[model samples]
Target: MRNNRAAPPWAHRWALPAMVLVTVFFVAPFLLNVRFAFSSWTSFRAEITWNGLENFGTLIDQDLLANAVTVTVLYAVLCMAIQNTVSLSLALALQRTSRINTIFRSAFFLPTLISPLAAGYIWRGLLAPDGAVNSFLGIEWAWLGEPSTALLVVAFIDAWKWSGLITLVYIAGLNSIPRSLLESATVDGAGPWTRFRRVVFPMLAPALTFNVAVTLVGALSAYDVIAATTGGGPGDHTRALNVVMRQQWGQGFFGSASALGFTVTLLVIATAVPLVWWLRRREVAG
Candidate 1:
């Protein structure tokens, strides 16, 4: 008689534990969150009756919804734009081999290694009216205090912290380009701009997709920087969805907060779905 193929021993031992943890921590909590989204909640009790789409209606009908969606979308777009532009520029500048390049790259990445809260606080001081930024420029604008400048400052802080990460991603993509392709292009009288536009960029699509996706999600979920810098202050001018959710939770609106969270997740998926599909098609075509 032939022996039956044995299951992997590691699967029998580790897989069950992994599944248990995932179910307990991730799947269970997510289900509970969905349940909360469909209920009415107070500080100590869930209404327990099915509210169906009422929670969603409240979330949508609020004026904060308009502000949240607009600001979040704008933040995502601006973050992607600034991060990609600065990162690609840095990647190009650092493609050369030199001690200076190594030092600059390390320095640039230092901010990313710091906690977002810490980085935000650091910049908060720097952007104060009497601080380094204004002192250096001789402009006495209060960065985080003014409604006009608060959101801009928050966006700038995020870009400063994360552009290094995108730069590294772009650098890896840049290195993956076939040297032979670059040399061949040079031989064919292709200028640096042509080589980048035609050969390098198309190849960097995968990296671009990743960088943009991360930037979008990160910017949309932005709270740490704003919390640390302005605490979503100046009359909520810099308040993000995450901050709003926190405020609701504090006000004993757990169900409402959960509903807002679910909505944000949906927004993320809505933004990512088309980009992911388009990138996959591009990969197939390439």
Candidate 2:
């Protein structure tokens, strides 16, 4: 008879190290920061006092807070929709075997390899008043200024830079579909759209879930690009929740920033949980 170990003994060895690292790096700092959110920092020693929910109440009463929430939601929805749609379309277009497909796929993914911050900086130069975009169009438009275009410009940039990454993910999902199922659908006289709707789409739900969730998170957390481009606006027109939180930090309102941080974290988890539940429910139902 062969003797089997009860679970892997090595798991116990790694558990302690993992817990220690997480505590040292993540959990401890997060708790400390949350404490800061409730306390004030002065010139003397780092003093932390219990301030109840004053920070949160103050944030809620600010106009900037309202604008930040609205803009953040708009950006998240638009960017996720556009990025996912365009990316999946491109992935579908490139799924075939051809020299053009290979070349196109490489071109599509190239933008994603560059850091988001770097891309924002590069775009800052190109979208300036006399930059190439407006120059080519023969009109001087404020890509980063003016309330009308500031948020739109940032949203567009977010979509352009990140769409390709989601495209690759979709491509992986597409490729994993069994060719036999597709062929069988074809033989049954199902049209291309029909096959995609009834068969291909369902199989890609997991990938779609992943892509959309990440895109939403990225959009909500957009700071570097907006900061690099318009510095949060012609006049805070494009300010997101993250931007507001950072401004609080800059003002040495650590307690307020920490409160905002916790708020944002909760908001993210709140949105993600419902989305994941719905997607999983549908996946199961179908």
Best by lDDT: 1
Tell me how far the alpha carbon of residue 270 in candidate 1 is from the true structure, in angstroms, after superposition.
Answer: 0.5
Q: C-alpha displacement of 204 in model 1, angstroms?
A: 1.0
| Angstrom error at residue 161, model 1 | 1.4
lDDT of 1: 0.84
Residue-wise lDDT of candidate 2 within 112-165, one digit each (tens)? 888778888888788888999989999998778878888877887888898888
- Poorly placed runs, candidate 2 (over 4 Å): 1-7, 40-45
lDDT of 2: 0.82
| Local distance difference test, each candidate | 0.84, 0.82
Give the TM-score (vs. native) of candidate 2: 0.90
Q: After superposition, how far is residue 276 of candidate 2 from its true place, in Å?
A: 0.8
Which residue pairs clash within candidate 2? 37-255
